[model samples]
Structure formats: C-alpha cells, structure tokens
Target: MTVLDIDGIDTYYGNSHVLHDVSLTLAEGEVVALLGRNGAGKTTTMRSIMGVTPPRRGEITYRGEDIVGKAPNEINERGINLVPEDRRVFPTLTVHENIVLAHKLAADPRPVEEMYELFPVLDGLRRSNAQNLSGGEQQMLAVARALVQRPSLLLLDEPTEGLAPVIVDDLRTMLQDVVEQDVTVLLSEQNVTFAFDLATRGYVIDTGSIVFEGSIEEIREREDLLEQYLAVSPEEVA
Candidate 1:
C-alpha cells in the first residue's frame, strides 16, 4: 500500500521557487531515500510533505486523501511526522519531558517507557536538558520524539548529519531495528553510504528536480552516476 504520495509538487518560499514539479511516493513499510547535495531541495521536499511549506501546485495525498492545504498540526495528527534536518528539540526540556510532550500530541501514543527502551542512553540522562545532551543524543531524542507519537509515515531528513562515525553507526543500527518494526520512512540524506544501507530504493534530486531513482543495487554500482550528481566518487559507495 502507498502511504504517502506527492505528485508534481511545486513548493516555493516567498518569491523564490524551491521545489519544481517534484513527485515521489512512500510505500507502506518501505525506506525510500532522497539523495542530493546541500542545496538540492531535500529539506524542502520533507517540509512540503509535513505541510510546513505547502506546495503552490500539485497534490499531496496521505492514504488516498488530499492533504495539500492541511495545517502542519492537522497533517501531524493524521500520523505523518517529520524529523527535520535541524533535529529541533526543546532545548530546555529534559529527555523525559520531551518525550512526554510529543506523547500528548498523539491520540494513540506509545508509552514513555518505549522511548527509553528504544534509546537506553536516553534513560540514563532522562533528567538532562536537551541542550546538555550530545549531538548524537539530541538526534536520538528527536527521532524518539517523532516515534513516540506512533506515526504511520515518518519523514527523516538527514538523520546522519553532523555526527561522529561511531554515533552514525549507532543510529544506523537503531534504524535497522525500526525497519524491522516496519516503520515507513522517507529519508533525505547527503550521506550516500548510510542512506544506501537503510534504503532499498531511492530518488536522487538535483537542483529542485528528481534526476535519478531506482533500486539501491542499480544506483550503487554506478560510480559515474554518483560522481556526476553527488560528487561522491570514492569507494565509500561500496
């Protein structure tokens, strides 16, 4: 089943056109990656889906319902959540407090214990303010915040951004568990290897348009494709 569908969306910010005729879909329980460099409209695509930045044209449907003009809260209430690239957590809130806040938003939220269970390191620092947590911890808390709401479609933008290799590895392992649990994810990333590891299929966007999309195997073996679009020519793709 297709969980979310974005067809021919043209999202703009003020007068500047950001996303041009961008279209993609997320199947139920599949991890789809949106690959691109820094300014390739990845975040814009995610924001458009969450309704933070509604598209000026085209249709966005969630489970066969049109959601182009829905408010962000309305969209979120429908079980679609976006963990933005910034990892925006309430800086003053404690780890436990943050999870509780998100739980309150859900009509059917998972227990607060589940967040701790998924992230035991967070359990150890339950009382620590979000500002005090490490970068990786904040990322985990951000993801935990979204997951606690028990969303049907989770939009994760650059989950591996700005962290040490060890933290990234830990996140990858945790996400593998999330995949096993069948959480439908649309991930946007500049980290090619990390995204490829989690995504079976992907769409590559360049300069606000989709340039390539296919199975991971098809994209993985093409060094020329990676090099021309992503400037990632090393053996990192392997």
Candidate 2:
C-alpha cells in the first residue's frame, strides 16, 4: 500500500524553481532513497513533503489524505517526521532536554530509557548540552528525537552528511532497526554506499528532476548514469 504519494510536485524558492514535476511513492514499511548532488533539490523535495516548503502545484497525499498546503506541524502531527540536513538540535539544551522537548510534540513518545537503548552514547551524556556533543552524537540525537515522535513515515535528509565512517555505519544499523519496526523511510542522501546499503530502491535526482528510479542492483549496473549525475564512482567508496 502507498503510505506517501508525491505526484507531479513543483516547488519554488522565491522565484527560483527548485523541484520540477518531481514524483515518488513510499509503500508501508518500505525504505526509499533519494540520491543526488548538492543543489539537486533533494532537500527541497523533503521539505515539500513536510510542508516546510509547500509545493506550488502538486498533490502530496499521506495515507489517502491530501496534505498539500498544510502547515508543517499539521503534517507532522499526521505521522510524518523529518530529521533535517544540518542536525538542528538546540545547542543550549541538554541532551536529555532535547529529547524531552521532542517528546512534547510527539505522539506516544518513546521513553528516554528506550532512546538510550537505541543510542547508548546518548545515555552516557544525557546531562551534557547538545552543542558540546560530537558530530556523531548530535546526529544520533537528531534521529532519536524524531523517533520519539513515533512517526509512521520518517523523512531523513542527509543523515550522515559529515560524520566519520564509523559513525555512518552505526547510523546505518540504527536505520535498519527503525525499518524493522515497520516505519516507512524516505531518506535523502549523497553517500551512495550508505544509500544503497540501507535502501532497496533509489530515485536519482539531477538539476530538479528524477532521472532514474530502480533497485540497487539496477543502479549498480548503470555506471554511466551514476557518473553523469553523481560525479563519483560508487566503486571507489566500496
């Protein structure tokens, strides 16, 4: 069943068009990857789904209900949560405080103890301020905060953008655990290894359009397309 449907979305930033006739779908319990370079409108597509950047023309349906033009919080309340690109944790807040703040907005929120189990380091630094945490810890906090919402559909935007390889691997495992709980994931990622490893299917975006959509194997077979759009060979990372 389709849990999220984005049909013919056209989004703009001021007068600049960022998403052009973009479309994708996410099935219940499935993980879909959005792959592209910087400025390829990957983040814009995510923001559009969250209603942070409402599409000027398009239909965004969640669980058969139209969500276009709704406010961000309204959309979020409907079971969609976003882990934004920059790991936007409140610097002044303690790690525990950050999770608690998220819980305030969450429905059936996860307990701090459960979050600690998912991210043990968070347990270790529960009293420390967010700004003092390392990059990996902040990323984990970001994911943990969103998970606290108990969202049915999670939108993760570049979750491993600047983390070390070890941290990225840890995040991969965490995402694997999330999907096991039957949450649908639509992840925007530039790291092909992470994307392909975590997602069975991927949609490749270039300029402002989806140029390819296929299984991981199919994408792996298309080196020419990968090089043309992403600029780096996945084999190098592999």
Candidate 3:
C-alpha cells in the first residue's frame, strides 16, 4: 500500500524555485533512500513533505489523505515524524527529560523502558543534559524521541552525517530494527555507503531534480551513472 504519494510537487523558498515537478511514492513499511549531493534539494524535499515548506503545486497525500498545505504539527499528528539532520535535541534538557517531553505529546508513546532497550547507553545517561552527550548518543536520543510518536512514516534526513564509523553502524542496526517493525522510512542522505546499507531502493537527485531511481544493486552496478551525477565512485568507497 502507498503510505505517501507525492505528485508533481513544486517547492520554493522565498523567490527561489527548488523542486520542479518532483514526484515520488513510498509504500507502507518500505525503506527508501533519497540520495543527492548538497544543493540537490534533498532537504527541501523532506521539508516539503513534512509541510515545513508547503509545495506550491501538486498534491501530497499521506495515508490516503491530502496533506499538501497542512501545518507541520498537523501533519506530524497524522503519523509522520521527522528526525532532521544535526540531531536537534534540546541542549538544556536532560536526556530523560527530552524523551519524556516527546512522549508527553506523542500520539501513542512507547514506554521509556522500551526506549532504553533500543539504546541501552541512554539508560545510563538519562539524567545528563543533552549537550553533554556524545554525537552518537545524541543521534540515538533523536531517533528514540521520534519513535515515541509511534509514527507510521518516518522521515530521516542524513542521520549518519558526522558520526564515527562505529556509531554509524549502531544507528544502522537501530534503523534495521525499526524497519523490521514495519515502519516506513524516507531517508535523505549524501553518504552512499550508509544509504545503500540501510535502504533497498534509492532515488538519486541532482540540481533539484530526480535523475535516477532503482534498487541498490542496480545503482552499485552502474558506476558510470553514480560518478556522472554524484561525482563519486562507489567502488572507491566500497
């Protein structure tokens, strides 16, 4: 079943036209990656879908209901949660406090004990301020917070951007767990290895437009296509 259907979306920021007739569909419980370099409108696409930047044209249907021009909170209430890049945890709040805060507003919050099982390290640092946590811990907190919402559609924008290899691996495992629970993920990422590792399908974007869409195996086999658009050799990274 289609969890999200974006048709001919045209998004803009002020007078700057970004996405041009972009169309994409995500099925229920599917993990799809949005791969693109900087300035390719990946972030814009996430913002548009979440209604932070409403699309100027086209329709955005989530769970069979039109949500094109809805407010961010309204869309979020409809079972779509976004874990934005930079792991935007509240610096002043304790780890426990942050998690509790998210739970307070969650439609169907998970138990705090369950969250601890997902990220065991968080159990020890529950009272620590978010700013004092390491990058990986912060990322875990971000994911845990979003999961509290029990969202059907999760939008992750570059969750592995600046973390160490081990931490990235931990996150990948966590995401794998979420995917196993039948959560649909729409991830925007520049890290090809990370993207391919977590997602079965990918959409490659360039200069605000989609240039390629296929299985991870297909993209990996097409070295020429990857280099031409993303300017990177997957072999070098592999």
Show the lowest summed lDDT stretch of 10 residues, model 1: 174-183
Q: lDDT score, residue 120, model 1?
A: 84
Question: What count of clashes does model 2 give?
Answer: 0
- What's the lDDT of the predicted structure labeled candidate 2? 0.89
**Can you give the lDDT of residue 175 in candidate 1?**
81
lDDT of candidate 3 vs native? 0.89
How many residue pairs collide in each prediction?
Answer: 0, 0, 0
User: Per the 3 Å backbone cut-off, how many clashing residue pairs does candidate 3 have?
Assistant: 0
- Per-residue lDDT over 1-238 for candidate 2, one digit per residue giving the tens place of the 0 to 100 score: 9999999999999999999999999999888999999989999999999999999998999999999999999999999999998999999999999999999877678776788888887898989999999998999999899988888999999999999999999888877877777589999999888888888898999999999999877887788767988776858544
Candidate 3: the clashing residue pairs are: none
How do the predictions measure up, each by TM-score? 0.97, 0.96, 0.96
Question: Across residues 150-233, which tens digit of lDDT does each residue of candidate 3 receive?
Answer: 889999998988899999988888878777765899999888888888889888888888888898888888887679876679
Please report the candidate that would top TM-score against the real structure. 1
- Over all chains combined, what TM-score does candidate 1 have? 0.97
lDDT string, candidate 1, 3-97, tens digits: 98889999999999999999998899999999999999999999999889999999999999999899999999999989988899999999999
Best by lDDT: 1
